[model samples]
Target: MEKTKVFTLVFKTLFFLLIALFFSWGIWNGYFSMIFTESERFLLLLQQHLLLVVTSSLMAVAVAIPLGIFVTRPRFAKSEWFVLNTANLGQTIPVIAILAIVMTYLGIGFNTAVFALFVFSLLPILRNTVAGLNSVDPAMKDAAKGMGLTPMQTLWRIEMPNAMFTIMAGVRTAIVMNIGTAALASLVGGGGLGDLIFAGINLRDNAYLFSGAVPVTLLALTVDGLLRLSERIFIPKGLQEAAKSA
Candidate 1:
């Protein structure tokens, strides 16, 4: 515990120092000269990026969860293999290829970008949901059922609560993946922080690139940390107490 706490403290200190260095560099380069104006644009770009990630990821979760549950159950024996193979195939398809296919059929811009992202984002969430749900203790499930709980109630009240950490872990992975992949949205004329990155690349300007890369990386880390924090919080109180006793 002491070691873990020390590590967490070190990480926090390093993260703050990175932020300080990023701002100081920006200021020295006149990048932060018009602080308010640059800040607004930076935030707007982040908003767009966040929108794309959240929307597409949630859409994926919506589709993935029900299908994950359905396929994992014994009654859907035949469909299980099909769902697994399809998600496997989805993961193998390159983002660029998916974007091209989407653009051809769905036209360009945000809608097409979302569709491509949805496809890219589905596999992890689907696979994790199935894995977490499957890993639930059979004894606990039987106890829930014996208590006269409906299947839905058992899922929501028992299985899901227990699987919270695992599910959040999958969500953290999906979010990080989406943040990186969302940059491809630029290919379809979908404006995002990717514009900053590509603009920098075209201009051979490192500052322009760092302007985007820094924020995106920070966002991913922040979100991932928060999810992990939430996983800690959502762990059953009894479990924490037991751990403390041990």
Candidate 2:
């Protein structure tokens, strides 16, 4: 089992290294010559893309985690459906339509894109958080209480820790979706790798298309990889071993 795990790790590392080398070769050889010649701002665009995904994800986390926790309480339990429905409603609309509608009111800029992305990111995180908490073993809660833990203590120490794996799964889904959606921000003057994609489309340049697509794909994979590491580090050790054995 350990040998298989090591082989899997090596394979993934080598795969990522090969992809990194390929992209580096493309950029170094000026495959995007047309793009750089017009404007030398590839790095700037990549940063903007990261900013969009990170900022919007953070904003969603701020609200979703707390709201999820709140709604699970017996006093606030009745509100869960309403809150979840509201998040689900935001997700029902197509992203393009949401961007177009939001742009009309917000007037097409970085902020508008952020607002649209934030709305797009809410449902998964919120839903998973509620599910994670609710799925916590009832016996564990009773044990915590029997040991003289307060409701808040039981939640923070026991419930939250046990539920963290599920919560992180939600976050991973949100961020991955956010990364893909962020590429569309270019349509609204929100600069990201999408600009290169659209530029390629407009100018009929495959170089520009690849220059944009490659980096965005790498970023998503890299972020997901990092979050996977986080899961290993944060999940209770027993759960991790159970996962491995399973």
Candidate 3:
């Protein structure tokens, strides 16, 4: 198991480095510098685009977590399946259509992008939160009750801790998804790195394309790495080992 984990981590690290090197090659090849003379523009674009990703992800987690908790209760379980299925279908809907409709209704810009990204970010967290909470052993709940813990206490002290790993996994997925979807925000004039991409496409400039594409890819990988680090830091080692064995 240790060997497998070491191998996996090495593979992932190498993969990330390879991608970064590829993008760096493009950037070094004068592909990105041809269009943008100001480094600050890239920084500003990163700030704006990353802001959208962070906000949308937070909104999804906020709404999904509570609904997920509510649905896990015995009273809501049966009907909650409907909500879950709805979310599943929401995932299946084309993100482009969702973005387009949102842009039309909201009249363009960041807000439309937020709405679209938020919707796109919902499913993984919602479904995983449900699944994670449900996967907690019932015996743990029973034990908590026998020990005189209230429902809230049982959830806070027992269920949530056990489910943390899965919830984090969902969050990681949402973050990566949000990062990718954010590029589409440029379509409706959200002024993201996508601005570089669309401008490139419009003028037939590879430099503009590389400018947009490289940054977005780096942003996704960076967030993914951070989330993976969070998982390692937060998840209990014993639980991780057991999970690996399972």
What lDDT is reached at residue 74 by model 2?
81
Score each candidate by Cα lDDT: 0.81, 0.91, 0.87
Residue by residue across 132-191, what tens digits does model 3's lDDT show? 999999998999999999999988888887888888899899889789888888988776
User: Per-residue CA lDDT of candidate 1, range 199-243, in tens?
Assistant: 778997766677777677878888888877776677777655765
User: For model 1, where is the 10-residue window of minimal lDDT?
Assistant: 30-39
Best candidate according to TM-score = 3
RMSD of 3: 3.2
Query: Between the candidate structures 1 and 2, which one is better when assessed by TM-score?
Result: 2
TM-scores vs. true structure, each candidate: 0.82, 0.85, 0.87
Q: 1 or 3, which is superior by TM-score?
A: 3
lDDT (tens digit, per residue) of candidate 2 on 51-169: 99999999999889999999999899999999999999999998889999999999988998998999999999999999999999999898899999999999898998899989999
Residue 224, candidate 2: alpha-carbon lDDT? 97
Candidate 1 regions exceeding 4 Å error are 1-40, 232-235, 239-246
The alpha-carbon deviation from the true structure for residue 113 of candidate 2, after best TM-score superposition, in angstroms, is 0.6
Q: Against the true structure, what is every candidate's RMSD?
A: 3.3, 3.7, 3.2
Candidate 1 achieves a global lDDT of 0.81
Report the error of model 3 at residue 177, Å. 1.2
